[model samples]
Target: MDGTRDPLARDERAELHWLRAENTLLRVQLDILTDIATGYAHDVDTILRLRADR
Candidate 1:
């Protein structure tokens, strides 16, 4: 008996594929957000340092 012929197995495989694709998308989004936050922090630090010099 081939596993592919089973309806339950096919549904599980479809769900697994969708979940993997979603996981990849979320990781990319997280990377973008992290870069934005890092840049914002650096900018704030530079502003504070410049103000302190005055």
Candidate 2:
């Protein structure tokens, strides 16, 4: 076994963990934005429908 290979393996594992954390954070942010957009659309639709009824 090569002694120098252990550090590379450790670095890869660390990088993988960081990438996963970043992905999770980005996904949560995306969900929040989606929720905001959906709410806005609902509000707009409501306003439009109310105006149409008048």
The number of the candidate with the highest TM-score is 1
- lDDT by residue (1-54, candidate 2, tens digit) is 665654458889899999999999999999999999999999999999999999
Q: Superposing all C-alpha atoms, what RMSD in Å does each candidate have to the true structure?
A: 4.3, 4.8
lDDT of 1 by residue, 3-47 (tens): 566455888989999999999999999999999999999999999
Clashing pairs in 2: none
lDDT of 1 at 8: 58
Q: What's model 2's overall lDDT?
A: 0.94
**Error of model 1, residue 35, in angstroms:** 0.3
lDDT of 1: 0.94
Model 1: clashing residue pairs? none
